[model samples]
Target: MSANHRPREGRPAIFVTGAASGIGRACAELFARRGWFVGVYDVDTDGAQAIAATLGKDNAVAGAIDVSDADAWQRALAEFWVHSGERLDVLFNNAGILAPGSFEAVPLARHEAMLAVNVKGIINGCHCAFHYLQRSPGSRVINMASATAIYGQPELVTYSATKFAVRGFTEGLDLEWSKFGIRVSDIWPSFVKTRMAASFAQIASARALGIRLDPEDVAAAVWACAVAKPRFHKTHWTVGLQASLLAFATRIAPSALSRQVVRYLAR
Candidate 1:
C-alpha cells in the first residue's frame, strides 16, 4: 500500500509482504474482515493501496516495499508502526517472483531476482519483523512455498529451485523459532490464479502435470495458519489434493515420480 494514506486507528496489526496482488491481496482482505489492522506492503504501492481501500480505511494501510531490501523492510515497518501505533502480531512473508525458462535457457538476471525476492525476501521479512512478532504472545509467521519445490519442473527449473529454497528456509525456521513461541508454516500452493503464471503458458499444462490451487482457498489457509496454534508444522500446506498426492509419491517413490514427471510434463 502507498505510504501517503493514513492507517485506520485502533486495531491489532498484521504485516504482509507482497500485498499488491493474488494470495497476498486476498489474505489482506480476509485478515481485515477478521478485524486486524492490516499493514499492506508491496512493490506496487498503488496496487496495494487499492486493495487496502477495498477493505476499508478502518482496517488497512498500504506501503511501498521491495521485501528483498533490508532498508525497505525497515522503512515499511517504521511506517506501519507510526501509522497504526501498534506492533505487528502476524507477519506474512508472501512476496515472490517466477520467471519461466528452460534450465540452460533461464536468464541469470531473472534467476537471481527470483531467488532474491522469493527466498531472501521471506528471510528478510522474518528478520525485520522479529521484534514486532515477539512482542505479541500469539505471533506467527507464514511463508509461501510452491508445489514446484516438491520436485523439479524441467521447464521451470530456476523457479523451482528458488521455491525449493523457500521450503528449506521455512522448514529451518520452524525448527529454530519454535523455542521462541512463534509458529512457522510453509504453504505449498500448486497453481494459483495469479499474474505470476504469465510465463507458464496454460493452466492446463499445470493441471496435466498436477493440481492448480485457487488464490482464495490458499488465502483462507493463510488466515487459518495465522490464528491456529502449532509450534511448527513441517508438512508444507499442500493446496489441492493432487499437490499432496504428488508430494506423497515423491516421498515414497522418488525414482518413479522423477521419470513420470518428465514424461507427464512433456505433454
Candidate 2:
C-alpha cells in the first residue's frame, strides 16, 4: 500500500464489490464523498485501483475479488478490514452478470455464470462478512436484486431467477442476522443505463419499459439504506418509478394478474 492510501483511523467503512464500474463504482464514490472509508473491490484489479485512487488515497482502498469464489471474498474483506479500522459498516453485494435471451437460446455456460455471479456471489459475500458485520455497530448488507425478480422475465429467465434468489436470501438473512444487529437489504432497480444493461437493451422488456435509472440512481438508494433507521419490516428498497410500480403491483395484484402484466411487458 502507498503512503497516501494508508487507512485513516475511526471512519465508518463500506466494502463494495464489483466496484470497477456501474452501481458499485457509483456507490463507492457516493459513500467516500460522504466521509466513509470505501473498499473498492472488483475482478478488474486495475479498474478497482483506479476508482480507489480517484476517491483519494485516504478515503479508499482497492482490491481484486471474484465474488463467486468464497476464498476470494475472505481475502478481499480481510484486506478491507485492516484499512477500514477493523470495521465494516456495510457490505454491498453489487457484483452480478446477466444473459438476456430466450431460455433455450442462451448458452448453458452463460446461464451458469450468471447464477454464479448474481446468486452465489451474494451468498458468498453475506456469509463471509457475517463476523465483521456482527462486530460493527449498525452494519448492513445490501444486495443488488433486479426488478425482474418481481416476476419471471421471459428473455431474462436465468437472470431473473438469480434475483429472486437474492430477494429470498436478503429476506432470510434480514430475519436471521437481526440477532447479531446486522441488517440485510436488497435493491430492486429496473433496467439501468450501464454497460451490462446495454447488452440487453434491445430485449422486449427493455424496449417496452426503456432504461431510465442510472447507476447513480441505484447508488442513492443504497446510501439511503445504509443511513436509514433499522426497521425490521423495511428490507427491500426499490429504485426508479418502474421498479416501484412493479413492486407495488406484486403486492396487491393476484399472481395470475401479475404474471399477465409481466408477460405483456416482456412480449
Candidate 3:
C-alpha cells in the first residue's frame, strides 16, 4: 500500500499543521505529488479531506484538528501513525491568523486566541513532533515566521510580536534539534493570497506594512527547504519583493522605514 507512491524505505510521512489552507495546503500538495505520505491536519475537516482525496489514498491522509490543541495533536498523530505507518519526514508549523487593529481597539479574547493559535500552537507542535521527528534521519520542521519579525508594524504590533517569537523559537530549535537529525527552518512569508486574509482592504493595508508573497510562492520555499542539505539558517528565505525591501531597510534605518510605512498606509 505504501510503496505505490513514495519510496518504501526511510521515513516518507510528512505531517503538516494547518494543512487545510494557504501555505500549509501548498506544502501538503507538493509533498503528496512526490509520492510522500502526507498527513494533513487542520481545523477545517472538509478542506483537509478535499486535499487528501485529490492526492489519492497512497499519498495523503487528512485529519481535522487545531494545532493549538495539545490533545488534538496527540490524537491526530496517533491516527496518522496508524494510517501512514511511518514517522513524519517533514512538519510545517503553518497555522496562523491576522489580527488587524490598534492595540486598544483589539479585544483581550482576540489577542489571547491569536497567541494560543499562533505562538503556542508552534510550541505544542514542536513538542508533539519530537519523538516522530527523531525516528527519521534528516527529518525537517518548517516554522512559519514573517517579515514583520524583522521590525515593528504600528498597525500590527501584536501579530509582529508573535512572528518574532516564532523567529526566536525557530533559531533556538535549529541548534537544539540538530542532535536529533531534524533540521529546523523558518519560512518568512510576506502578504499571501489566502481565505484567511481575503479582503482587498486587508491586502492593501498589509502592503503598507510590507507583505506581498503569494501563497504558491511561499509554498515553493517550504518544499525547497525540505529537500536541501541541512544548515542552521537563523534568517531563512523571505518572499515578496516589497516586504523584503522593507525588512532590509528596517534593519538599516528603522525610523526612516517607519515613516515610509506610515505614509504608505495612510490614505
Q: Which candidate is the best by TM-score?
A: 2
Error of 3 at 151 (Å): 1.0
How far in Å is the alpha carbon of 160 misplaced in model 1? 0.7
lDDT of 3 by residue, 1-267 (tens): 121333345547788888888888888888887767888888988888888888787777788788889999888877777666666778888889877777788898888888998899999998987888887667888899887686666667788799999988998898888777777888777677787666335434565554356678987888777777655343376777766776677767868767776456643
Q: TM-score for model 2?
A: 0.96
Q: How many clashes show up per model?
A: 2, 0, 2
For each candidate, give its TM-score against the true structure. 0.90, 0.96, 0.87
lDDT tens string, model 1, 1-267? 344555555566788889989889888888888888898889998898888878776678888999889999999987887766566777888998887756567678988898899988988889988887787676778888888888877667777888888888888887788788777778887788787766566333464654366678888888767766564444368877767877888888867766687467656
Judged by lDDT relative to the true structure, which candidate is superior, 1 or 3? 1
Error of 2 at 139 (Å): 0.7
Q: CA shift at 108, candidate 1, in angstroms?
A: 1.1
Give residue 222's lDDT in candidate 2 (0 to 100): 92
Q: Candidate 1, after superposition: displacement of residue 9 in Å?
A: 7.5
TM-score of 3: 0.87
Q: Name the weakest run of 10 consecutive residues (lDDT summed) in model 1.
A: 202-211
Winner on TM-score (2 vs 3): 2
Q: Sort all candidates by lDDT, best to worst.
A: 2, 1, 3
Give residue 240's lDDT in candidate 2 (0 to 100).
94
Give me candidate 1's TM-score against the actual structure: 0.90
1-267 per-residue lDDT for model 2 (tens digits): 322445778889999999999999999999999999999999999999999889898899898999999999998888888878899999999999988888899999999999999999999998899889888988899999989888889988899999999999999989988888888899999989887977776589899998898999999999999999775347989899999998999899999999999889877
Candidate 2 structure lDDT: 0.89
Instruction: List residue ranges in candidate 2 displaced over 4 A.
Output: 1-5
Ranking by TM-score: 2, 1, 3
